[model samples]
Target: MKFKITHVTTYLFDSEVFLEPHYLRFRPCQTSYVDVSDFITTIHPQPVGHKIVQDEDNNVVEFCWFEGMTTQLTIRAESVLQTKSYNPFNFLIYPQSFNTLPFQYNDLQKKLLFSALEQLPISKGLIDYALSILKRSNFNTISYLTNLIKHLHDDFSVEYRAEGAPFMPEETFQLKRGSCRDLSWMLIGILRQQGIAARFASGYYYFDMIAPAYELHAWVDVYLPGTGWFDLDPSHGIFTGNTHFPLASSAHYQHTMPVSGGIRGSANSKLNTQLIIKKL
Candidate 1:
């Protein structure tokens, strides 16, 4: 399937402000199952200089520098891409040791996935919550993960918030209601606490013949020795495949933001975003 995507972000300030260098991570990437073409980004109050570079996590980043003061800023990004359908379950066999809970990683794998395995403080209730859906005695890695995804999908009510930082994992767990980002973060923390290597992913997702739902999405990738990285979306209760186009994957959600920069001004700003994705 081929698609064209348009995303626009605008910031209106109360007063003129000097814009600083900004980094954008919104560009689509070419993957084995996805091909990107005809990508473009337009910025208002034209920037003085710009460059494209790949970041540490391999995300394509566009850096732009501005020249003068402006009361408004707008960034528009457009892209065309083709995605090939594939089975989400086409994962390589995982290492035998990682097939069960309380699993241990080999030395080399441990060193490589250290950050993903870092322990974060989570409540006992959270641990119990994760355990409730698992079959401890007859544990299977794939089954456990699928069950967890289904549990979240079936139990949590989806709440769409137009603006705000995501709720902390603990808060989301306690409330059992959250936005997509909140759920992704909660899943990451839970998997990390369980000694599994999981990271946050941000990107675009669309189903065939579906109406164009325009917004950024969040999901996760778990690192299993043989499987490499397995993408999962608890928000949709499905394994991520051709429909998911990842722009960035990181150990934290903040690092996956599409735009990051600042303005020098005492004035407050209002943000507006618009997105359109259509099949071609």
Candidate 2:
């Protein structure tokens, strides 16, 4: 299937402000089951200089710089892409040890996935919450993840607050509901607590409905020894496949933001975002 997408982000400053260097991460990579046929972005008050480069996290990003002051900044991106259907479970976990709770990664794997495995302090209740799932899954790695996401999907409600950083994982777990990002982060915290390596992913999700609308979506990636980084969507209670197009992923959600930069002056700003995706 082919998809055409248009996404616009506008920042309206109440007062003139000097623009700073910014980075855009709207380019979804060409993967084994996905192809990027065409992609382009237009920026208003055209940037003075820009180049696409891979960041430390290895995300394909557009680094841009600007000149002069402006009251409004706009970025419009359009793209056409093709995605193929494939089974999300067409992989295997390696190192038999990793197939169970308290997974033990090989030395090299642990060294490389250090950040992804790091666990921030979570509330005791949340920790116990994850433990309950671990118990329910009988300590099986794959079953645990499947059960975790399913519980979140069936128990939690969805919210559409299109802006702001994701809620703290502990908060999301306590609240029992949140935006897609929040649920993903909540899953990340739970996995990390169980010694599983997980990270954040952001992109678009194609809904299986008539004339579906889409916004930026967030999910999680769990690293299994032989299978590499495995995709999991707690918000949707499934592993990802063709319908999920990931733009960028990082150990931290903030790093996956489509736009990253700052203004030079104290100009209060209002942010507005619009996204449209269609089957082509």
Candidate 3:
């Protein structure tokens, strides 16, 4: 499948701001599953200085500085590409090494992970839950992984919201709902606790939107010893094949945010944002 993506993010302030330094991880990367055929980014009130570099995790990072007094800023990214499709249920699951990886837990993520498992009422940690699920199945790893993916999809409701919105994994579990980011983070944390290497991914999804707009999105990719990384979107109830494009990934949410910055004058002033996404 081929898709065209347009993403525009604007920042508005109540008072004039002299300078703004920003870090952006909005550029999609070419990987085994997806290809970035064409892409471009434009900023309004043109930046005075800018530099692009690859981060330690190999994610493209763009740093920009603006001069002069400005109250509004906009950054736009557009792209065209083709994607591959894969069965959401068919994936590799390594159950034997569920207790060996070093698990460094994040405060928010740890809370969410344990909370989600607690809601399962399984009386077991994440690894035990995965093992129990696997033990009941006689299928191969692919089938087992697929079944787990499907279980999450059928069990939860999809919830979409803007970035910076506060949410707890336990809350989502109680409601039986969550956004892609929430689901991905909770799942990754649980998998990691079980000795699985899973990472959080941030990017855009190209498709007809029910809301008539596009937005930043999140998902997860878990590593299998022999098959490598496989993408999963528990919120969408879909297994990402070649269609899901990746922009950046990190062990936790703070690292995967598309943009992070601070304005000097904003201590007392309010900051507002407008984001627009479209398929070209």
Candidate 4:
């Protein structure tokens, strides 16, 4: 499928600020599953300086600095692309050996991995609740993953909310709810805990049912042996495919914010966001 996406984020403040420096991770690269046919970005009042570079994890980054007093800031990004069908089971096996990387398995990673596994129906977490459904004897990783995705879709609700929430994996599992960013964080915590190198991806998604608009989105990717990193969307209940394009990725969301800066004055501020998407 092909789609055109428009994302607008605006921040309004009550008092002028001396300077603002921001990092943008809002551009997607053409990859095996998706193609970036056209793209553009516009920042209001212009910027003093900006540079595009690649980070340690290889994600694209755009850094910018704004000088002088300012009370409002706006950032807009648009894109056109095509996405492919997604199948999580197909990515169960890592294609290459990621063990050679500098990444090392630590105690925190192990604890998180074990915790995620235990929470699942197959593991020791909530076996009784899962047993009610497992008695049917029709279960596999593919099925389990699929069911888990759907379960999240049905049981949880998505909200724009704020970005101030502390990254807590245990709380999310207990609440069984959060925005895409929260879910992605939880998944990343689990993957990292398991000795799997995972990262948080922030981007835009075009969904037919949810108001044809592109909005800030988040997902998680797990490093497989041979295939590299495979994308997963617990909020969507499936693996992401070509339809998903990443702007920036990092070990956590705090590292890949689309726009971040400091305001000088103590002014009450409000933020508004709008996203529009359409099939091409």
Compared with the true structure, all predictions reach lDDT values of 0.85, 0.89, 0.65, 0.65
lDDT of 2 by residue, 110-182 (tens): 8999999999778998888778888999999888888988888988887877788999988887788899999
In what order do the candidates fall by TM-score, top score first?
Answer: 2, 1, 3, 4
Candidate 3 collision pairs: 84-242, 89-146
Clashing pairs in 2: none
Q: Which wins on TM-score, candidate 1 or candidate 3?
A: 1
Residue 141 C-alpha lDDT in model 3: 50
Candidate 2 global TM-score: 0.97
TM-score of model 1 relative to the true fold?
0.95
Runs of candidate 1 with Cα error greater than 4 angstroms are 208-211
- Best by the lDDT measure: 2
TM-score of 3: 0.77
User: lDDT of candidate 4?
Assistant: 0.65
Error of 2 at 93 (Å): 1.3
lDDT by residue for model 1 (1-280), tens: 8988899999999999999899898898688788897899999988999999887677889999999899999999998998887877776666677777869888988988887787767789988888776664367788889989888888888777767666878999889899888888888888898889998898888775455556788899898878888788988888888878888887766778888899898989999999888889
- Over the stretch 200-279, how does candidate 3's per-residue lDDT look in tens digits? 78887666658766567788876654355667777666677555678888665667777777776753444344445444
